[model samples]
Target: PHQKTVIDVEKDILYQNDMLAQRNRGYFDAKNVLAINLVSSPGSGKTSLLERTLTDLKGEMEFAVIEGDQQTTNDADRIHATGTKATQINTGKGCHLDADMVANALKGLKPKENSVLFIENVGNLVCPAMFDLGEKERVVIISVTEGDDKPLKYPDMFHSSTLCIINKTDLLPYVPFDIEKVKLNAKRINHQLEIIELSCTSGEGLPLWYSWLKSKVLAPEPV
Candidate 1:
């Protein structure tokens, strides 16, 4: 009885979140915004990648950010330093950013039409996968230092993400991580997953990432 009750409550919570997510999607569509949710474990270089992306693309497009963290507003501060609009959402005990939190953030962010909105979810591979923040793309990042079996270990995140980024490739020589093995593992979990390997510090393979972003934003919407 206890297990059934807990399961029922979980389902109800997810149902509510999904409904809110739909509303967020509508808002993004109405504003012509491409929202991307960045998810990964701590130290996966998500922030670094965002910093590089914002700095490099600042003149090309407008950007807004919602930085999620369990504590400080450090990530949001970094984003604001780039001259982009950003708002911080401190989740406190929460491990993920839910749709409702994002909806509230949007009011404060007010991202311009035809702009990109990056929601940097709290660094956790598990919980973030279950919540739908109404993002157009869910990108899961894994640093080479975190090992090659991340997708196998956290199948839910890998299965849910649209893109898998292999970051910190500059350390590939020193680390025991296998790029091919990780790609294989990720493909096994989600064959449709698009993969990108890049090093933020060395600036290798970043152009492809930038091109991918532009293509997605520029792609015509389905009628």
Candidate 2:
């Protein structure tokens, strides 16, 4: 009897996804749009960071967002409230956003040339790590309320991400999260992982985050 193993099917799925991702990359390159994929566990302040970013940089640079969630357009509504163009993809039972999904969303978003395109992926660290959406950078957000051992627990996510944002710094005084420990653990998994600490509530460390985004937008080709 003919049979296919789970690994075989998984490999085929990833290969197909990667191919589509490359096509998305080519499109972004031709359009001169800087796309960033933001992945994180739920309630990690990904939406808050984006809201503040869009509000702060509204006049300085044009930005658009593609929000992925299991259901509801709540996050996209928040982004729209900040006056940024946004498209929402309701993944239903899907755990993560794939390149094909982003490609479809881009059609409706119609992102402007030379603008920043942020993809707020579904709030799951594991699945998103396996799907590259042809973004210039993959950013993982972890709030201070979460354990420092998260990087160790989710090595694949940390390893695949280009940058990690340690958010909710204002809660550090109340929470037991250790920034140094988180950094050490993440670095052990990914030596080249760039990290930034910020508090979206109080605006601390936000300038550095904004600077990082600006740099990426200026470069746009993955530096």
Which numbered prediction scores highest in lDDT against the true structure?
1
lDDT of 1 by residue, 1-223 (tens): 9999999999999999999999999999988999999999987998899999999998898889999999998999899888889999999999999999999999988998889999999999999999999999999999999989999999999999999999999999999998999999999999999999999999999998999899889443566
Give the alpha-carbon lDDT of every model.
Answer: 0.94, 0.93
lDDT per residue for candidate 2 within 10-85, as digits (tens), equals: 8999999999999999999988998999999998998999999999998888899999999999999999999999
Instruction: Identify the runs in model 2 with alpha carbons over 4 angstroms from their true place.
Output: 1-3, 219-223
- The residue pairs in collision within model 2 are none
**Which structure among the candidates has the greatest TM-score?**
1
| C-alpha RMSD in Å of predicted model 2 compared with the true structure | 2.5
Score every model by TM-score.
Answer: 0.97, 0.95
TM-score of 2: 0.95
